[model samples]
Target: MNRKLLVLPAVMGLAAPVLAGCGDSNAGSGGGDSIVIGTTDHIAVSKELPSPVDPATSYDGGTYTFFNNTFQMLLGYERSATIPSPDAAKSCEFSDTKSETYRCTLRDGLTFSNGHALTSEDVKFSIDRVIKIKSDYGPVSLLSNIQSVEAPDDKTVVFHLKASDATFPYKLATPAAAIVDSEVYPADKPLDGLQMVGSGPYKLDSWDGDKAVLSANPNYKGLVGKLNNSKVEVRFFETAADMEKALADGGIDMVNRTFTSDQIAGIQQGKEPNIKLTEASSPSVRYMFFNVDDPTVKDKAVREAIARLVDRDALTRDVTHRTATPLFGAVPTGIVGHSNAYFNTYGQPSRDKAAGALSAAGISTPVKLTFSYPTDRPATPNKEEAVALQKQLNGSGLFDVTLKGMPWKKFLPGAVKGQWAMYDLSWLPDFPDPDTYIAPFFAEGFLNLNYPGGDIKNSLLPSTRQTADRGQTDKDFLQMQDILARDLPVIPLYQDKQYVTTRDNITGAEWLLNSSSTAQFWELGRGVAG
Candidate 1:
């Protein structure tokens, strides 16, 4: 019953890699039962991604959603659920009291969509490949606890951990550990392009850059006993409005990913009579990270000064239109480890306080800085927020800020290279755990802050992971958030209020979430409206 948390924490805007040549806009034959889902969030295909949908190297939640449905994992969450249950494996459990040894037995008759026999070896290959490839943007860090993976026989696999990590099962359920066919995937590199070979609930019938069609995989032998619908079609558009138009025109049956703040406001007003609304008290969050490598921001004083001056009230109320609440910790509100570290340290936005910070460090006035955000992010007010943030920082006279808008493709690479001084990033948990939120900052250098996460990474993070009891992690998580607050490597902005809109006739829209508690593509089906 625990859930939430992610790799590419999401893809409200970023498409790291996806299927190429999805081919044709035509829907597959499912009669009145066919369902089409639309999003401003694009699904895959990028020059940046070496493997289009290789689970080991892939990071986007959108990609995870697609892959989770297509690729089998040793464990998986049931529909509308959080805790991972047996999917590829018949059952999985820690074989030791220390949580260091985990073992699993595959279901009796498992096969990849290609009918290649699925085995413990595939499970071992899927995981070992991840740690080996170690993609900079991938979820390698999530598996840092595992020392080795062993397949004693065709049916059984065991994980030998470097240390006790209670959260390891949840990590296996993520796309990072998604099982790929050893026959199809390269041992050390990603399988190139649109070719995805798996034994999950659905087969990617087709995928073009803008649309993807999925159909039930009869070969699938784990998880759901049967599918709710036989086919699913995903339409990716350039904007939320375009997605909304598709929903209104009956081109798509459901709307997920994003609808701009204004569109959501109108939808909340009950203007879209045929569309149903469901709001999730979500754990989703977004933040702006400083590239500590950047000369201007390298000094902790400048970062702290700017952090003190920037306004969150304006961002939540004016920019996001209250669709989000101010977030003060890496762990957002509604998550188990939530804290108000930033708010506790800096009471509120104040230029005088910001001036004090810089003066204390002997840094001069009006520090020149370039701030950037993804211009391509959908349904979210990222660009507007960037503009607002630029003004807020500049207005304080503590900074002279310029704005740069990077499309999602260019955005991540530039971020990895520390191209922008500071840029915006968003996260959604692949599972509901503090590790999903905090571990990456240290394990993989995914944040690329250039600040070596000394004690937080090597000590606090390991300490938190060593226990299965999430409640016991509260104090440690708080301390970690406080350290982040003091260091100002990344500034918490706001946590989201997620909304999914479905056409009046659609069923199971309320159950749709692409991230942690992942949408069971099979759970969606045609039914009489309530």
Candidate 2:
């Protein structure tokens, strides 16, 4: 994907807006021998899955991992108690300068669920296709440094970098680097109608647009082996409430995305025998965007004033019901280069500072700011967040806030064209890298959804990307954060914690912090009886 690659939906996080009218079910049940996962979105298998599945794009891991089980990098994370092991690639070694090159060797005898041999050609095909299609689906920017990919044999793959980058391997470990079957895929075409063919443990059984039927690949020979279940069916719902209803009605067995604080607590609070809610820190951050094209919001002072007047703690605690952490910076927690620039710079939510900033910028008149958020969409808490922001800003007496709402299917286009005065947006990291967070906001960034052109790109972005070393890059990244905090190109609000409700019978459902944050299906089967 070029600059627009991954740019279209970078702001839409994994949390769908299904919780608005969802209610608790007094009863929950499951199929005798199957694990059915429920969600509000469906797979777009039109083209090849982006190697990292473009974390900036909608959740594609449900399909990406079903094809390419092996990853380019694998390492253990200690954040969760399960201490889950990534079943993809075994290990990775970086260059001495963290910028030279990386050499990855696939596990010998690895076969796709279809029994196709997974070789270097397949890897090349996966990455090359993204650059070929030139859409937002691939992580070409992270792969731009690759002078060439030389795969001399089936087991060994070598990446020649144009410049040194220590984090490049991590990018490979992401969903964007998932290897697809080159023989099954054609070159120079959109991946819309192609039949699913991948080396992952699950093979595509059927896709009827709104639903996908997957069968366990008997050929899968890995540490986890084939899935215990015979088939998995995914159904998308327009709302979370309906999904929950379907779960109770035996339409689905699991809910895989974000849930409201009340819903999550109700599950935990009730201790329903068949229900379980697991919480973990996610790499997603919810923030507001200011369209630079809007003349009234174009001023840095107005943006800063808006940021100052809003209380992040209250928003997170009251609005999110403590399901999220008050965030002071755009970079989500658990990543490098995350800083508390918002808290440090603004000190606290203060009407006085907001008024002072506006007054200093020669704005005596109360600025009438129109806030835009998704309306009646069942995938995000956009409506709740927007209402809280409008209330706080309006109550500050420094501005007149009007809330405007639209559905996500339309809101996305409007925000892209810079049609909103102030918009609320959320970001789920495409890759677990600072670049994923920083690059998207830069005017030149392929995922710069806000499109805040000005010194943001000329001064802030160039300075940060110039530093090649990780340590120096850290400094550059902090400097960029400083700029974002001071100008409030978009006010960073809070980082969300992902919570999933499952039955006690489920086990090994670990969340990968990579591009997908997906659960390894094979590793999860029938758990030991309680």
> lDDT: which candidate is best?
1
Give residue 170's lDDT in candidate 2 (0 to 100). 47
Cα lDDT of model 2 overall?
Answer: 0.58
Count of residue pairs whose backbone atoms collide, per candidate: 14, 25
Estimated TM-score for each candidate: 0.91, 0.78
* Candidate 1 structure quality by residue, lDDT tens digits, 306-389: 788878899988898998889889997655677999999988998899999899999998899888777777766878988899
Candidate 2 Cα misplacement greater than 4 A, ranges = 1-32, 44-98, 153-155, 221-230, 249-251, 271-273, 413-421, 449-477, 510-516, 528-530
Worst 10 residues of 2 by lDDT: 1-10
Off by over 4 Å in 1: 1-32, 514-517, 528-530
Candidate 2, 1-530: lDDT as tens digits: 00001011223222111111111111111223656777764444432343222322322334444433323222222222211123334434543444466665555666665667877777777766655665553345655567787678876667777655555644664555666666666555534452556555566777676666766665553334334455566676767777767765666766765455667656767734566666665766777777755877878888888878878888887777887888887776555577898889988878888899999989865788888887854556778888888888888888888888876546765665567777877766555456667765565344334555466556655554434443355555677788888767777888777766565566544432223354544444456221
Pick out the ten consecutive residues of candidate 1 with the lowest summed lDDT.
15-24
